[model samples]
Target: MKSKIGIIIGREFNERVRKKSFIITTLLTPLLMLGLLVAPMLLSTYSGDEQKKIAVVDDSNIIGAHLQSTDEINFIETELPIEIARKEHLEEFAILHIGKDIMSNPSDIRLYTNSTASITMEMNIATQVKMVIENIKLQQQDIENLPAIIASIQTEVNMQSFANDTSEDSGDKANSSIVATVIAYLLSFILYMFILLYGSMVMQSVIEEKNSRVLEVMVSSVRPMEMMMGKILGVASVALLQIAIWLVIILGAGYFIIPELIPDEVAMAVAMLQQGASPETLNTDTDMSLLQAIATLTDVGYLAKIVVSLVVFMTGGFLLYAALFAAVGSAVDTPQDAQQLQTPITIPIILSLFVMLSVINDPGSDLAFWFSMIPLTSPIVMMARIPYDIPTWEILVSLGILVATFIATAWAAGKIYRTGILMHGSKPSFKELWKWLRFK
Candidate 1:
């Protein structure tokens, strides 16, 4: 019996793996994901290379001297009326008009642009003007170097967090909430995608075979139970293979390529973070938040735990859903017919995704814990909680429940599959499905 199932599994596996679609998708998906991550950074860097020149008509003459130039924008002072500046300096991006009474009537200041202005550009100009107005107000009071006093007292707070689960010595190393949140979001999403995509693949495959009458020939020799298990396992092997390939690509880039690609300032910032340095101690030019995130992701032990948890949950989740999908496939003659039956199965999966969003915010919440305990939702909800370094006992209980649920679900689905695989012509109603479950 096992040999027969193995043969069927081999046939199904080879058939799909040999397809051009499989090979193309396996190779291109990583590149597409990479593009999504890199595109924003590239656009931010080069999209505004040309500096926007603003013709400043400082009627008060107080604002222009304080106005500064950034790489993306320049403030050019022009000795002309606001109207003249707008008309004559058509080549400039905008005309900034400042009223003489601007100290009291701040609304008198305006910007006339040749075209629509971006929020960022408008905010920049408004900020500069607002600062000048404040300084003027301060000078009117005749205080002793008030501007320098304010600048000297400027301060920002950076709070370092450590997990209570760590040892006393390990408490010195701060944990990043941002890293945990990002990892949780990504893992949950990946688990959701894997379950939905692979589970549907099993359904579609069953539908195609049943419609083509290929299953009629194959099931004559192999038992329906064996065929069902064989098909589920076959497709599962393919999914695992694709995931392994993706992991290799991702880990290789994270460990070997990405570190080399990051700027030296980023590395220095990460090093400072490890040594318990405050945000103020790191180079102001470096993006400390991004560097800290990268450093946490590249941790060998942490990454390994996340990957293992994902694979375990992914396998259990897919199998549990895939069996139900196969049963739905066997009952229906077409994809349209399967839709009504699949709704109940799909709702839990969809609900889990929505719940995952909330889980990232509070992994220890009662809602997260209960949802993670429920087998139908645990795969996604638990993966989200895993990155937060939740208790190991909770994970073990979730995994045990998931395994038991999969076994029970597969057995129940097997009964439906064996009966539904042979029945045809008419769609089965709830009553008819109940009868099939009771069949000897």
Candidate 2:
């Protein structure tokens, strides 16, 4: 039986790889997805390079000097009228007016623009204004070492964790949480997509075979159980191969392209080792400690455990759904008939995705825990929660139940497959399917 399953898996893997659609989609899909992810950053970079011209009417010289030197800002030191500033091409000038009311209150700096200013421009103005106020305050108080005093003020609070016998740094804990959440989301989405894509493929294959009367000849030679197992194994092998190839490509690209493409600050953070800098001196702001950041990415053992659990759940989930799809195909004579039966399978997937999305923000919540424990939803929900630090016992229990559910579902689906594949013309109702399950 194992050998037969192996043969079926091997054949399915080979056939899928040879298909033009699979080959094209496997390569292009990742690239398209990567483009979407990076598009905003690319646009931001392009916009950052463009010069922003601002006309300043400085009645009081307090803010003009401080705001003049910001990057990509061409400060035009002009006393131009507001009308002239507005009439000038919008790309060429924005006006900043300092009112006479600033002698008593230095905070009265007004900006006039035709439309709402960009976030970058607003931030730059706010920062400059803040520095001016701080300097004025220092002068008023007659404090000479204000710069040193300000530098010594600690803006970031140091955090330490004491849980689960793990000595992870605060950064490591955060990274672990992030990586776990990302991995969970990725696994859930992948399972959802693969189940829909390949499960449909299985159904289509069954319908084609039945329509052409090929299933009649094929079933005479092999038991329905063997054939169903073979088909499932074959399709699953193809999915695994495609996934493996995509992983290799994505990893390779991330390794090589990321270093060259990412901002220097982020690159530096990713490259730094945790031990290289003292925990006190480490900058929490930049990606200067990427090596440390990645090192701190959850416990390696925990990550491995979650990954393995995801594979088990995803495989079992796919098999369970694909078996139902196969049975649906067997019962139907055409693709149109299969569509009506697909709602039962598709609804669960849609619900799982919806529930997983909601639970991700609050993985430890009661709703998340209960949904993840239920067999029909567990495969996706449990994966979504794994990144938030799930217990080993919960994983084990989920797997135990998932495996049992798969066995029961496969047995039930095989009975339906065996009975319906041979019968034609009259479509089976829910009652008919229950009767078919009792067939000897």
Candidate 3:
């Protein structure tokens, strides 16, 4: 049985991975992942490089004095009429027309452009007009303290976790929470994608074999259990290979690309860490600098733990879900038939992603506790809480349940796969599947 399974695994792994699509996907997936996230950030940052010149035809005369230029836009007050400004071609992007009594009707302010006005263009003009009007209203009401009141409002509150363990520094706790939340989010997302992608692949692999009646010939030589296990294991290897490459890319980007791209943000985060330094070590404020704080946050130890946890959950989740997907493929004659069976399998995966925000905010909550431990959701949910310091017992319990679930599901799926892989005609309903499972 072992030898047969090994041969099947090798053949399946070799045959599928050598395909043109598989090779191209493996090579391009890292590039695609980086592009999806980093492209928008980079593009948006440089989007406002060129300053747009907007001519202001302020009939009210009040707005022209207060309308100041910004990095992305330059405002110049003009005495020329609106009709003449349209034809003058002053190299301006747009013309803002402020009405004489805009104090009465704010909507009278209009932006006219040679081309259609963009959202940014409209917003810039509107903001200038609104700010002038607001300042006038505040003066009229004699509310000179408005600026001071606004400045005094605290927008961000520092959250400190008060667990039994207070030996950890507040700065360390804050940094860890940030790191844990980020790791949890990435892990949950990766697990969701890995499980769905590989699980569907397993189903499609089974469907292809069944549809061609190739399983009929294969069954005579290899036991159904061996064939099923071989297919799952073979596909698992493919998944691991893809993920290993992705992990290297992710770690590389974290170490190299991130700092070069967003230096200011990196500097600010490091500054924050320095500000929140440990209370006991308050004597050496001059010595602790931004570089040291940045180094602390990017600790090599924490990153390794996150990477290992991610690899484990991603593989385990794929294996657990792939069994059901394989069973669906064996029972169904067509991809459409498999869709009905996929809903039940996919719900828990989706639920895990949806509820992860709550878990990240409060990993010790009861809701997070049960969801992370339950076998169906554990594959994604447990990893989400692991970085936030999940209990040792809970991790053990979740792993035990997940492993057991995979074994039982695989055994059950094998029974259905053996009976249905060659039996194709009418679609199998839920009742028919129940009968197949009971077969000796």
Candidate 4:
């Protein structure tokens, strides 16, 4: 029985890996994901380099001079009226007017642009105006050594955090979140694609064997349970191989290419740090020691505990659903009939994704905890919650439920497959399926 299962699994794996579709999809998916990860950074850099010209119609020279020297802004003096500027499509020109109360109220300066200013441009203008006001006040007080006093007065706060009775830097939180989000997304998407890919492969294999009447010959050699297990294991092995290859590619890219290809924003942030700017000010805070943090979070001696837990849950989740798909395929005479049954299975996955998004906003919510505990939703939901730190007992309980579901579903699915594979030509109803399940 073991040897027969092994042979079947080997055949299934060989057939799937040799297919061109599997090869192409496996290679293309990671590259596409990498592109998506980097696209926003590339676009932002391109936009930042594009010069935006602005015209200053400063009735009082105070606001205009201050706005001119601000970063990333090229300000030009404009004597033209605001109405004329608008009529001429003057995005290249804008007006800055000091109201009649400028002497007593310098804040009464109005900026008139044909269009709204970019966020960076607006921030730069505000900063420059604030600096000018500070300088004016200092001069009014006849203060000397103002620059030294300002430099000395700027206080930097160093914040730290504690988790699991150990000190942790506050900077670790952002990095941890990113790592968790990336891992959760990767695991969830993999589960999703594999179930669709391998489950369809299982269904198609069953249909082809049934159509060619080869299943009858095979059944004489192997038990129905063995045949089903072999098919699932074989396809699963193929999926595992593809996943292994992807991991290798990702790890290689992270070590070899990612540093070189770091986005300009990230690079600029690093440069700022080299020049003594605080990480909070520059906003490039991905420098957390993820390896250390993961170790701390698990409190387990090995990383394999979390890894094994994820694999077990995912495998159970995949097989549980795959068995249903196989049963559906067996009961149907054609692919069209199989597709109709797919909607019910698909709805849970779609709902799981929506729930995962909600987890990002509120990981500690009761909704998240309950969703992660339910076997049907647990695989994806629990994987998402891992990054946010779930209790060890919860993980164990979820895994236990998932494994039990897989066993029960596989047994029931085998019953359906055994009857449906040999008896075809009509779609089976729920009542007929129950009858098939009871058949000796």
Candidate 5:
């Protein structure tokens, strides 16, 4: 019996793994993720290089001199009238018109452009004019060195945060909640997608085989329960393999790329700390939050724990949901027919994703704890809390519940699949399915 199940598992596994779509997807997914990460930075770097010139027809006359050129914009003062400047400087990006309100009415300023201007461009013109007017008013008050006084008093504060608890290694170090949230969100979303993607794959495969009468041939020599388990486990192995490959590629790239991002002085400061130098001896301006974020991600122990938890939860979650999907597929003759039956199974998965957002903000909240404990929602909710260093006992309990739930679900699904796999030409109601479950 075991050998027969193993054959089905091997056959299902090899059939998908050998497909060109699988091979292409496995190779391209990491590259696509890398592109998503790097594209914004590259665009920001090159987007501001070309400056747009604006012809200034400042009726107030004093404001034009204060207008400065930035990487994205250039202000050129024009002696021509506003109407003439609009026509003559049509080649320019825009014409800035500052009213001769001479002392008040800041609303009189306007920007006329040859073409439609971006909000950024309009904001830039308004900001420069406003600053110039304010400075002029301050100077007219006859205060001594007012500009210098304001400049001297200008200050900026960058706050650093640290966790209160000192028991764990992460507790003593500075923490970046932004970085933690991003990581948590990414992990949870990936887990959610994996379960849905692979679970649906199992359903679709079952439906396709049933439609083609392939399952009829196989069931002659195999039990429905064995066939269902074999297909679920087979697709699970394929999902895990794909994830393993993605982790290797992403981690390998991060290892090489992260060091290049660190400045030489910062790298030296990190080395100094490792060599027994005190934190005070290093550069005071070093961004501790960024450093800590980098250190947290690269920590071998933390990474291993996360990876292990991901595999465990992903497997358990996929199995719990896939069994229902397989059972639904077996009961229906077509893909459209299966949709109506799959709604009950899909609701928990969708609800879990929405609840994960709140869990990220307050991982220790009662809402998070309860959701993470429930087997149906635990996989995503628990992963969101893991990055915050939740208690180990909670994780163990959650895993235990998830495992027990999967076993019970698979058992129930097996009963349904046994009868439904042979049924044809009719759709089963909820009452009918319940009767099939009790078939002696």
Candidate 6:
């Protein structure tokens, strides 16, 4: 029986992995995800690269001298009438209008744009005007140390957090907690995407086999349970293989590819992040410690715990859902039928995803505790909590429950698959399914 299942597994794995669609999708998915992560940074960096000209209608000219040009926005003094400046051929994004009585009432100053400008554009204008106004007000008040006082206004705070779990582990808790939280959310999200994707793959594979009229011949050679498990294991293996490839590529890019593309300072920061350097260690005077905070997140024990838990949950959830989806595919003749039956099977996962998202905010909450214990939701909810201070006993209990649940679920699904895989003339009603489960 083991040999038969292994042969079936090998056959299924090879058949699917060799397909052009599978190969292309497997290789390209990581690049697409990398693009998603990198595209935003690139856009923000070059978003305002094309400098926008601002028409300065400074009648009083008190603020015109202080106005300056930045890489994002450039101010140009315009003697043209307000109406004429509005139609300036220089492609100005906005006009900074200063009334003749601007100093007594700064409210008379206004910024006009062709259309409603972005909040970012408005804020840039406000910042420049505020600086000029401050200097003017300071000059009128005869303040000598204005520059010194203004520099000290936005004081930097070097805040550090410590974990209260154990006194012996008392260093800065800032690094571990933050890094763990990020890993927990990201891993759980990845699990969710994989389960949804490959779970449906298992179901579709079964349906395609049945629809082609080869399910009967296949059944004659292998037991329905063996066939079902083999299919699940094949798809599961494929999913894991793709994930491993993506992880390697992404990690390699972060370490090697990205550094070469970015500036020296950014490359240095990325290197620091990879090496686990804390921000406080880099510069005492500067509060830029976010990269160094990631250093403590590389705790060997913490990473091992997450990896072990991730593998278990990913396996448990896939096995549990794969069986259910196989049954769904067997009961229906078409993709439409399979999707109709999928609503019940998908509800728990959907509900868990939404609830777990909220649980991520407060992993120690009562809702999170109970949800993490429920086998259906545990893979997602428990993962969200793994980054926080979860007890070992709780994780053990959850795994035990999930294992038991998957066994029961697979057995029930096997019964359904055994009957539905061969029954195909018409759609089976809910009553017929109940009888199939009771068949001896």
When superposed on Cα atoms, how far off is each prediction in RMSD?
3.0, 5.0, 4.8, 6.6, 2.7, 3.8
Better of 2 and 3 by lDDT: 3
Give the Å shift of residue 90 in candidate 5.
2.3
lDDT of candidate 3 over 399-425, digit per residue (tens): 888888899999999898888897888
Clashes of each: 0, 11, 0, 0, 0, 5
The candidate 1 region of ten consecutive residues with least summed lDDT is 166-175
Per-candidate TM-scores read 0.90, 0.78, 0.80, 0.74, 0.90, 0.85
Best by TM-score: 5
lDDT of each: 0.86, 0.74, 0.79, 0.70, 0.85, 0.79
The local distance difference test score of model 5 is 0.85
Off by over 4 Å in 2: 1-10, 28-43, 57-62, 89-93, 96-145, 158-163, 166-175, 249-292, 297-303, 423-432, 438-440
Model 4 global lDDT (CA atoms, 0 to 1):
0.70
lDDT of 6 by residue, 1-440 (tens): 44478888898889888999989988898878778987999998898688888889988878887888888889889899777887773467788898887778868888888666889888887888888887788778977787788798967675545445564433334445566667777888988887888999999988899989778998988899999998999888887777777766766565566446555664465456445445545533323445434444434455567767877888888888888899888899988877668888899888888877888888888999999999988888888888775887998899899989999988988999999999887888778887888898
| Ten contiguous residues with the weakest lDDT in model 3 | 282-291
Check candidate 5 and list the clashing pairs. none
Q: How far is candidate 1 from the true structure (C-alpha RMSD, Å)?
A: 3.0
lDDT, candidate 4, 210-293, per-residue tens? 778787898989988888888887877777788778767876666567557666666565444434344457554454233223
- lDDT by residue for model 2 (243-294), tens: 7777678766766775676666654544453333444455556442343336
Using lDDT as the measure, the top candidate is 1
Q: For model 4, which pairs clash? A: none
Against the true structure, candidate 2 has what lDDT? 0.74
lDDT of 3: 0.79
Error of 6 at 38 (Å): 2.5
